[model samples]
Target: MMTRLKIGACLTLDTLPDHRDWIFEADRDLELQDFLSHAALTTDRDVLIERARQALDGFRGKLSIHGPFEGLDIDNKDPELRPVITARFLSALEVADRIGARKMVVHSPYTLWYQNNLHSYPGYAETKLARIHDVLGPVLRRAEELGITLVIENIQDVRPETRRAMVDSFGSDAMALSIDTGHAQLARRMSGAPPVEDFVRDAGAQLAHVHLQDVDGHADRHWAPGEGEIEWSAVFRAIAECEAPPHLVLELRDATHIPAGFAYLRDRGLAV
Candidate 1:
């Protein structure tokens, strides 16, 4: 049997012209923020919601949202900032429910700096993991209440074990994993992190979403899949073997590169 999966594109205003029949992960921008922030809910969000409804009126496919994580850390130990971060995540979750997003992609808090000095401080990882649970426990419960899957995406995670541990700790059906190929590649080349395949291999059945992009082995190039030096065959092979295929999202930097990305997958006989 051929490798079959629900392939999707990241939805940006510039790329909406090419968004026929493809599943989509809503892009983060001013519009999304307006809907996600409690402060902007009344005036700014009302207009954006109407516009979004009109724009997506004819679209027929599954939807996901990328939750806010720019400066928010679920593992933050600060007493004052912890509540603030929790509120932001709660807001994001509410927005996800309103938009009919079945899944929300959140960034992992594991960082390169922390990993580099992890050995010096014994049990630090465990403590941080506990903090993460404490902060996100309610959010995860709320997501479960809303029938949404909370997918944790690897950002600067040098190794998969820490993140895998955190996800396992949740023990909620609503909690899952996401793999960003470009971010994983950049972590490996720039920080001597594990190979990109390691993430898919470890995530296994827990994988629920993906950010499929090409990288030049150093920076987050986000080029078309075939335009960079990533080993595509191994990546696809790993994905094909998953117990349940994840949502493959073409999250390219430019809208113009999306067709080329789809073409690359087609040429490889991996298109769904």
Candidate 2:
């Protein structure tokens, strides 16, 4: 029998206060502050490595790492902020290397400016393009040398052209795409963004990872497969048709949801 697609949780090892505010209510006993601090400190790398290994035990699926999403900026214009981003990525890399993970997911710096702005100004696209090259150039180059794959994700209607542009600029097999399903849904609903299949195809040779989640037309719900209205069968079909099957990560909030999601994929004959 063919194996199932990998299902993994996003570790909010160092989330921002605003995001953690909701997580507290979702998982009351998680001790968010302590976990974040522990993940931030490298003295505990072995412990973190074991935790990830344990998390994947008995599972015959590939593993991938989601680096610190909160307060991480690969495209920061300030020289001071670059090291902070690099350190966070390196920490995640250490854990991933320990667990034999093949891909590390990182977001562009769009969230920093797009959070408050309601309008899409003229020069915004050009500005973000320049920022992406400046911020991710060194990091992507180093990732190539280190044999680590860095997959850049799209957020808030980041144009497909821009995504293609960034990957072409890097021109390295180590650099690729991480397509977030919910984010793509949100972009389609809110901004009339192009279809998910189109994005995947456009990404072409650089598409290396995927984040699967279900959401309504509004906020990201992160619901289990078949629990929400997403057309998962279509999504999987698109993935199957890709030139290469990128790593498919469930990106669920909880581990409890993983079994059901796996079952759903199995029932659809997509486990392989």
Candidate 3:
């Protein structure tokens, strides 16, 4: 059986038109990245949101936005930081709501240190998890009310299961898991994490979205699918078992390479 999933693109207004025709499918997501810009989310908020709104005027495909994540840890322990982080997230979700997005991508905070030490340090897991729920609680309620799902994407995560556990704790449909192929590759190389393919199977049905990019396994190169060392076939095979029918987003560092990346998957009969 062919699990031919639709491939999508992560784009800014500047690159959206460049890849617009290629991203015409209704289920093929266009992950907007402009909102992730600090300036765009803060002082220039309306201007950039209007720019994005205008750029998406005629497109009817599913939409998802990369939420603002730079230093905005969802589970920050400092009480003072919680509201600040909460406010920033809600601010970004407003953009998501305005853009008619059903999904938003947020970064994960799991690390190898946490994975190894959470048990050793009593109440450590609870502290972080409580912080997460407290911070994300409002944003999640808004996301659910707006019919949006916040997919937790892996970054420096060496432990996918722990992240999954964290996602599961929310016990809400508005929360799910996301895997960044390039991030997984980097984690595998630097921290002895499982292979990128395993990350997919590990996320299983809760996997709501994916960021497809290739890396040299040394750094986040974010190259087109075939431009790096990733095994595309193995990755897609793993993706097929995901019951969420996860949104496969081509999140290249160079957005212009999207067509080539999509074709690489198509030529190999990996994605539809």
Query: Model 1: which residue pairs collide?
Result: none
Instruction: Show the lowest summed lDDT stretch of 10 residues, model 3.
Output: 20-29
Candidate 3 RMSD computed on C-alpha atoms after optimal superposition onto the true structure: 1.5
Superposed model 2: Cα runs more than 4 Å off: 1-38, 41-43, 53-61, 110-127
What would the per-residue lDDT of candidate 3 be over residues 207-229, giving only the tens digit for each residue? Answer: 98999999998999999999888
Give the per-residue Cα lDDT of candidate 3 at 136.
94
lDDT of each: 0.76, 0.63, 0.88
Q: What's the candidate order when arranged by decreasing TM-score?
A: 3, 1, 2
Score every model by TM-score: 0.89, 0.75, 0.95
Backbone clash count, each prediction separately = 0, 1, 0
lDDT of 1 by residue, 1-272 (tens): 55744466776434565654443333321112234344444346556556666666655466677777766888988868887777778877876777667788888999888888888898987888888987898899899999999999998888877788789988988999999999998888888977788789988999888888999987888898998877777787788888987877888778677777887887788765
Better of 1 and 2 by TM-score: 1
Candidate 2 residues 1-272, lDDT tens each? 33344333454443323233322332311111112333543677677666645644443444466666676666667778777766666666666566666667777554424533526676665666666666666666667766889888877644665666767777788888888888877777777777666677777767788777777869877766777666776677677677876876566666457557757877877753
Q: What is the lDDT of residue 236 in candidate 3?
A: 92
